[model samples]
Each structure stands twice: as C-alpha cells, then as structure tokens.
Target: MPVELDPVKSAQKRSDYNGIYRLEDLTRLSEAVLSDSGQVDVMLKCTYDEQKLPVMLINAVTDVDVTCERCGQPMPLHIELAATFTPKTMRLEEDLVPSNYAIVEVNDYGLVDLRALIEDELMLEIPLVPKHEVENCAIKEQDMVWGELDKAAYEKPSNPFDVLKSLKNPK
Candidate 1:
C-alpha cells in the first residue's frame, strides 16, 4: 500500500515511513509504461528543519519499460527521485518557502497525499522521448524516413501555353 500521512503532524513527531507502490496504483504512470507489473520503493521522512519549518524528504526508485520512440519497441527505463519539500499552507507562504526545498501544498485538513506526490515526481522523471542507446536501438538514424517525393507527382505537367506555341510555330 502507498503511504499517506499528515505532513505537519508527522513533521512534529519526526516520523518516517517506507512503502512500495504497485505500478497499477499509479493510474497516470501506468498509462505511460509498457508493462503493468512493477513497483516503486518509496521512503518519506518528515521533520522540522533548523528554520522551524516542517519539511519532508522523499526518495523513490522504480524500473519500468517504455516504448522506444525510435524503434517502437519496449526499452528499459529506470526512474529515481530525491527531493526535499516544505508544506505550504497558504498562497502567502509560497514566497517564504526556501528555494532549496520544493513546496507541496497542504489541504484544508493539513494533510498531503504522499502517494500522489511520488507518482507525480516519477512522471516528471520519465523522458519525453524514451529510447534505447544508439548502439542498442533496432532502428538507426540512417533508417529513419523523413519523407519521399513521388516520381509521378514531381513529373513536369504539360504546359497549356505549349499548344498555342505549337500552332504559332506550325509544329
């Protein structure tokens, strides 16, 4: 099961949680992956920083297969995430959040869904165009087809003015 806890409360107690999220649990990420069976190892620690701000440290890792854009075949992709985030209770706090730590929004109940957060972070780590290395991809750059001109389409069309010229020249 995925981990979900109150960031502020957990931080006050300096709590730590470790869990695994099945790929299927992440609906958005599952759609982008080639295989349906996999799991992400997640570790979350909530504590008060020296500035008296509640922060959470997150670490997540996963291995999955994504379609190679070049060859249209499945390729292995490893995703790793490490981030520090301070809970933002109000829009005004956005400016107060330190630049070194990311800001995660807290709900009216002061709870932040760690499962969704990890899924979102994983999605961001995925490459826009997943592909195997040049030496490994079945399709190479030289094999790519940009386009080809049709021989019939490129043939010069008969000029309408040619008839008039032929009549004037008696040819």
Candidate 2:
C-alpha cells in the first residue's frame, strides 16, 4: 500500500505517525526496474515528523541471482540491509554535511513513492565485486587463467639501464 502524507496536517504539528509496509510491493518494484531474475524482499516502518520529514526505518533481506564478476559463474547473493532514509526540504552545504549519503525529496502533499524508494535503496546495496564462495566453482579455472593474463598485461618492463649493466657484466 502507498503512503499518503498530508503536508498541511504535518505542518500543523500533527506528525509522528507509523505504518507497516509489505514485501510483495517491494518485489513488484524490483520486477518493474530490475531484471526478471532479480528478486527483493523488504519490510519497512515509516515515520513522519512535524516538518514533513519522512524517516524510513527499513529491514530487508534479498536474494539476487547475478553474473559473478570474479568467476563468470551464476552467483546467488544474499544481503541484509538495515538503514534509515531521511527526507529533507532543503539541501545542506557541503561543509556542514552530516555524512555522505543519499537524500530524497518529499512531495508537496508529502506523498512518497515507497516502491521507487525501496528499489533505489536495494540497487545501492548491491556489491561492486560479486563472487561465489563455493570451492571448485565452475569458472574458477577460467578466472585463474584470466588473472594470469591480466598480470602479464600490467607487468613492468625490465629497466633499460639494468639491461645494459647486465650485458656489460656478461651475467
């Protein structure tokens, strides 16, 4: 279910409300934006303050099937994310920033697209270097070969001065 925020009521000091959201709604969001193979499950408790600031206290567990970066094998990943999202009306200066974090805006009526918000949060939680932990993974040999090739490509050449010295020494 979507959350509705009444800005007028919020501005009048009628804030501090809570609600329970479901996991199926989050899955639908993943289906719309993510690949069909991707899956997400989430539950969140949302709170609003008198300033119309929405704070989402989220606890989520997800299993996503994605191509592994290290081994080229299909990897199934499990992730648990617990975080809070705060909606702000104004952007703070860089010097005064609390921390480096993402900020989303609340609409005039304080209505937020929970689907989109959760989807984005899940995307951010994905690992940059995905890999499988199982031993003897199908692509392990292939990955080793690729690693050797990469090492060769980046290896430093022997110093020309050193080469000349070696030649002079006949060693």
Q: Which structure among the candidates has the greatest TM-score? A: 1
Candidate 2 displacement at residue 127 in angstroms: 1.4
Q: List, residue by residue over 58-147, the lDDT tens digit for candidate 1.
A: 999999999999889899999999999888775335766678898888777877888888899999999999989988999986876778
Q: What C-alpha lDDT values do all the predictions have? A: 0.86, 0.56
Give the Cα RMSD of candidate 2: 7.8
Query: What TM-score does model 2 achieve against the real structure?
Result: 0.55
Best by lDDT: 1
TM per candidate comes to: 0.80, 0.55
lDDT of 1 at 119: 92
For every candidate in turn, the CA RMSD to the true structure comes to 4.9, 7.8
What are the runs in model 2 whose C-alpha is more than 4 Å off?
3-39, 48-54, 90-102, 134-136, 141-171
